[model samples]
Target: MIKLKELSRLYNINKTIVEYGLIELLPRQHRPFSYTLMRIVLFWVRTKHQHLSLPERLRLSLQSLGPIYIKLGQMLSTRRDLLPPIYADQLAYLQDNVPPFCGELAIKQIESSLGKTIDELFENFDATALASASIAQVHTATLREDNREVVIKVIRPEIEKTIQADIQLMKWLAQLMQRFLKDSERLRPVEVVYEYEKTIIDELDLMREGANAIQLRRNFLGSKLLYVPEIYSDYCTKNVLVMERIYGIPVSDIDALEAQGTDLKLLAERGVETFFTQVFRDSFFHADMHPGNVFVSYDHPEDPLWIGIDCGIVGTLNNEDKRYLAENFLAFFNRDYRQVAQLHIDSGWVPEDTPLEEFEFAIRAVCEPIFEKPLSEISFAAVLINLFNTARRYNMKVQPQLVLLQKTLLYIEGLGRQLYPQLDLWDTAKPFLEDWMKEQVSPTNLLKKLQQKAPFWLEKLPDLPELVYHNLASGKSLQKQQKQLIVSITKQQQKNSKSYFYIGIAATLTLVSTLAYLQTDKNLAMIAGIPGLFAWFLAWRHTNNE
Candidate 1:
C-alpha cells in the first residue's frame, strides 16, 4: 500500500504529467483513453508543461524529485533500448551538481562518527567541497598520521527521509505498472526497483560503500587500467569516510586533458578496456563512471592512469549473464545479426515465439546502416536506442544489468567523443572480448572446474560397476515396457485409421445417392446430371485411395 502523503505527491506530479501531454507514455491498457484525453486538456491549461519536448519533460520531473529520483533518472537514461534517444541524452545531465553542505557540518559529522575531533583526524581539511551530489559530497584533506593527502566523503544529513519517501513513490509506480501494463510480468519493474533500492540504500551507509571500494581496489590493486582510492579505516564512520586522494585531471575536461598533452586516443581505448576488464575479470565495477567521478593521472601522458572516486553504484553480473553479454558483444562486432537475435531469444531478452529471422532482419535493419561508419560519426548510444525500440515491437524484456552496462558504455562513448572522436569502440573492445572469451573457455578453466569436483568423482568411482549393473537391469526393464507401449499405440493408431476410412466411404456413398436421386427429380434436372455422376465416381476413387 502507498502512503497518503506519497500518493498526494504523485498526484501533484501527475498534474505536471498531465500538462506535458505524456500520460500517453504510460501503458495504454490502464487508461482506456481517459487518461490520454485528460492529459491533453491539462496541457492546454498549463503553459509550463505544454511546450517542452519529451526529454525536457523527463528532465524537469526528475529535477523536481529528490536524489533517489535523480539516481533513478540517471539509471533510466542508460536504457537506449527502452527510451527515446533524445530522452537518454537529456537525462544524462542529471548528475545533480548541487552545492555541498557547510564544512562545519562535515567536520561535526566526522567527529561524531569517529569519536575524535577533526584536528586529531587530519592535519589539513578543505572547507569547500570539490563536488556535491545527491548521496554524498567530497572535500580534500590531509591526514596528520601519515601526511597523506586524502578526500573525505560524507553522506547527506536527513537523506534517508527523502530517499525513503521517493522509494515509496517508485514502489507505487512499479506496482501500478505491474498491475496494468501489458506484459507487466516481463517488465519486472518491481524487481528492478527492488534491486536498485538495495544498492542505493546500501550506498546511504558509507561503510558499505567503503567495503565495496576496498574489495574493488583489491581487485585492481596493482593493475594498470584504473585505480580505486584507498579507504582510511580508522577514521571511517557510518556517514563519513576518509580515503587517499591523488591529483589527476577529471575525465570530462576534454580541453584540460588535451592541453596537458594527454594521449587522448590511448586514454579512450584504455577506458574501454578498463570497463570490460572490471565487468568481466573482477566482476565488480565502479558503476558510477561519470566525468566527475573519474580522473586521469598526469604522471604518464602517453598512458594516463584512471583514478576512480565514488563507489556508491557498482554492478555485478552472474557468470551466465557475463558469458551471454560477452557473446553478444562478440556477435555484434562480427556483424552477426542473426546470432544477435537468437541470443536475445536464447537469453530470454525476447519472447520464445519471437521469430529468429524477423528479429534478425530488424537488428540488421538498425545495424546495417552504420556498418562501416567511423565510431565518431555513429552514435553507439543511438544505435542501441534504435535496436531497443525495434525490440519493443516484439515485446522484449529489458535486461537490468544491460541497462547499467549501456549507461556505462554511453558514458565511455561520450567521454571518448569529448576526448577523441576517432576512437573506435569496436576495435578497442573486440580484442579484449576475444582474450576474455579465450580465458573463460581455456583448458585451465575446465581443469580448475573439474579439479573442484575431483573428490566427488573419486568417491563415486568404486561404486561404478554396481551402478552400471543397476543401470543395465533398469534399461532392460524399461525396454520391455517401451515395446509393449509401442505395440499398444500402434494398434490404437491402426484402429483409428480404419475407422477414419470407413467414415469417409460412408460419407461418399451418401453424397452419391443423394445426387442420383435429386437428378431424377424435376427440381434438380439441369443442376444434377451426368456431371454429378462423374463427380461421384471421382469422390469414390479419392476415398478408396485413402
Candidate 2:
C-alpha cells in the first residue's frame, strides 16, 4: 500500500509528466487516459514553460522530480544512441550544476555532522559555496589548528528523506512500466533503477567517497598523467568530508589552458592514456570524470597533467572483464572485426546461437566507416553508439557493470575534443593496449598467476592423498547405491505400469457401459458399469499406495 506522502508524490509526478508533454512517452493504452486527466489538472495548475522544447521539458521534469530522476537523466545523457541528441545534450546539465541549497543550511548541517562549531573547526571558512552538485556542495575552508587549506563537502540537509521518497517513487514507476509497457524487458527499467539506487545511496556516504579518492590517489601516486587530491581523514564523516584543496584549471577550460601555455595536444593524449591506465593497469578508475570533476595541473605546463576529483562513483572490472576489454580494444585497433565478434560470443556478451559470420559482418559494417578517416576525426562515442546499435539486432545484453565506464569514456572524449580537436585517441591508446595484451600472455604474468595461487595449493597439499582416498571410497559407495536405487526405480515403474493397465481397463468398461445403455441393453449396461466402477476404485487405491 502506498503512503499518503507517496500518493502526493505520485500526484505531483503525474502533473509534471502531463505538463511536460511526456504523456506521449507513455504506453499506448495509458496515453489517452493520462492525457485527459493531466489536461483537466492543467486547467487549474497552469504551466508557463510550455514553450520549452521537448528535451528541455524533459530535463525540467527530471529536475522537478528531484535527485533520483536527475540522476537517471544524467545516466541517459551518455547514451546518445538510445536517445535524441537534444535530450542527451539537455540532460547533461544535471551532472554537477543542479541548483545549490542555502549556504546557511549547509553550515548548520556541517556543524551537526562534525559536532563542532564553525569557528572552532576552521580558522577561515567560506560560507559561500565553491561548487554545488546533486548530493552535496563544497566550500573552501582552513583548519584552525594547522591553518591547512582544504575544502569542506557537506551533504544537503535532510537529503536522505527526500532521496528515499524519490527512490521509492522511481521503483514504483519502474514496476508499473515493466508490468504494463510493451517490450519493457528490453529496457530493463527496474534493473537500471536498482543500479542507480545503489550508486546514489553509496554516494550519500561521504566517507566512502573519501576512501575512493584515497585509493585512486594511491593508484596514481608519483604518476605524471593524473593526480588525485589528498583526503583529510580526521575531518571526514558520513555527511561531511574535508580534503586538501586542489588548484588547477578545469579540463574544459581550453582557452585558460592555452593562456597558461599548457600543452593542449599532450593534454588530450594524456587524458586518453590516463583512462586506459586506470582501466587496464589498475582495474580501478574514477568513473565520474565529467568536465566539472576533472582538472588540469598548472605545474606541468609541458606535460599537461590531469587532476581528478569527486571520486564518489568509481568503476572496477573483474579480471575476466579487464582481459576481454583489453583484447577487444586491441582487436578493434587492428581492424579484426571477426575477433571482436568471437570475443563477444566467448565472453557471453552475446548469445552463443548468434551467427559468428553475420555478427562479424555487422561489426565490420559499423566500424569500417569510422576508420576511413584519421582517428582524430572519428568520434569514440559515435563509434560505440554505432556498434551498440548494430549489436542490438543480435540481442546483445547490456552489461550494467560497464555503464560507468561508458559514461567515463563520454566524459574523456568530450574533454579530449575540447582540449585538442585533432587528438588521435587511437594513436594514444593503441600502444598502451598492445603492451597490456603482451603482458597478459607473458611468461612473467603466468608465473605471477601461479605464485598468487601457490599459497592455496600449499594449504591443500597435505589433504590431497586423504581427499583422493575419500573420493575413491565415495565413488565405490555411490556405485553400490546406484545399483540398489535402480532396482527400486524398476519396481516402482512396474507397479505404475500395472496401475495404468487397470486405469485403461476402467476407461474401456465405462465407454462400453454407456454404449450398451444407449442400445437398450440395461442388464449388460449394469454389469459393465459395476465392473468399471470396481476397476476404477482398485486403480485409485493402487495409485494411492504407490
Candidate 3:
C-alpha cells in the first residue's frame, strides 16, 4: 500500500525527472498527471536550460534528488545498449561528491557512538574531511594508542529517515509499474528496488561494511592484480568505522595513470580478470565498484594493480547459479546458441513450453551481429542488454540475485573501456570461464569436497552396524507381510473367478430360453426359463458365499 505522503513524494520525483528532459522515458498515458504537469513545468523551465543537453540535466537532477537517485544514475551510465551513446558517456562522469557535514557534528557523532572523547581515541584528528559522499564522510586520524594512520568514517546524521521515506516512494512507484505496465514483469521493478533498499541500508552500518572489507582483503591477500585495505575492527561500530587509510591514484584519473607510465591495456585487462576471479574463484566480489570506490596502486605501473575500497555491498552465488553462469558464458563464447537456449529451459530461466527452435533462433539473431566485429570491438554491455531483451520474449523471470553482479560487471566494463578502448573482453574472460568450469568437475575439487565432509561421515560411522542390523530385521518383517498380502490377494482372485464362471452359466441359460421363445415352442421355452432361473440362483449363491 502507498501512503499519501509517499505518493506525493513520487509525484515530486516524477516532476523532477520531467524537468530534467526525461519525460519521454515515462509512460505518459499511464501517468496523466505527469503528462499534463510536465507540459506546464517544461514551459517554465525550458528557457533557463535550453542550451544544456538532456544528459547534463539528468545528472544534475539525480544529484539534487539525493543519494538514491545518484546511485541509480551511476548504474545507468554503463548501460550502453539501453541509452544513446552520448547519454551513457555523459552519465559516466556523474560524480558522487556531496557537501560534508560540519566537522563538529562528526566529532559529536563519533564521541557519542563510541562513548569516548575525540582526544581519548585519536592522537591527531583532522577537522576537515578527506572525502565526502552521499552516505558518509572520511576524516584522517591517528590512533592514540599506537600513532597508526587510519581514517574515521561517520554515517551522515539522521540519514535513515530520509532513506526510509524515499524507499517507500520507490516501492510505491515499482508497484505502480508492475501493476499497470505490460513489460514491467520482465523488469521486476519491485524486486529491483528491494535489492537496492537492502544494499543502501546495509551501507549505513559501518561495522558490517568493515567486516566486508576485512573478508575481501583476506580473499585477495598478497595478490598483485587487486588490493583490499585492512580494517581496524577494534575501533569500529555500527555508525563509525575506522580503517587503514590508503594513498593511490583514483581509477578515473587516466591522465595521472598515463603520466606514471602505467600500462593502459594491461590495467584494463586486469580489471576484467579481477572481476572473474572474485565471482568464479572466490564467490565473493565487491558489488559497489564505481570509479570513486576504486584506485590504482602507485607502486606497480608496468604490471598495473587495482585497489578496491567501499566494501559496503558484496555478492555471492550459490553452486547452481555458479555452474549455470559458467556454462552459459562458455556456450556464448563458443557461439552455441542452441545450447544456450536449451540451458535456459533446463535452468528454468524460461518456461519449458517455450519453443526451442524459436528461442534458439532469437538468441542467434541477438548474438550473431556482435560476432561480426572483432572481439576487441564488441561491447559486452550492449550484448547483455540485447540478450536480456530477447529473452524477455520467452518470459525469463527477473533474476534478483544476479542484479549486483550485473551492475558490477557494467561498472568494470565501462571502466575498462575508458582505460583501454581496444580491450578484448571475450579474450580476457574465455580462458577464465573455461578454467573455472574445469575446476568444478575436476578430480581434485571432488576430493576436496569429500575431504571437507569427511568429519561428518566419521561421526556417523559408529552407528552403521546398528543401522545395518535394524535394516536386516526390517527386511525380514517386510518379507513376511508381503507373503500374507499375497495370500489374501490370491484368495480374493479365486472367489472372483468362481463368480465369473457362474455368471457365464446364467448367461448361456438365458440365451437358450430366448431361442426357444423365438421358435414359438411354448412348452420348450417354459422349460428353458426354469434352467435360466436355476443358473441365476446359483450365480447369486456363489457371489453371496464369496
TM-score of each candidate structure, all chains considered together: 0.74, 0.82, 0.83
Candidate 2, residues 132-197, lDDT tens digits: the string is 777788999899989889999999887888888877777888888889976456556788778878
State the lDDT at 463 in candidate 2. Answer: 100
Worst 10 residues of 2 by lDDT: 74-83
lDDT for each candidate structure: 0.78, 0.86, 0.86
Question: How does model 1 fare in lDDT?
Answer: 0.78
Cα shift from native, residue 392, model 3 (Å): 1.6
Q: What shift in Å separates residue 301 of candidate 3 from its native position after superposition?
A: 0.2
Cα lDDT tens digits, model 3, 280-344, are: 98899999888778899899699888999889889999888888898998999999999999999
RMSD of candidate 1 to the true fold? 9.1
Error of 3 at 447 (Å): 1.6
- Rank list by TM-score: 3, 2, 1
Candidate 1 residue lDDT tens string, 145-173 = 88999988988888788778777888888
User: Which window of ten consecutive residues has the lowest lDDT sum in model 3?
Assistant: 41-50
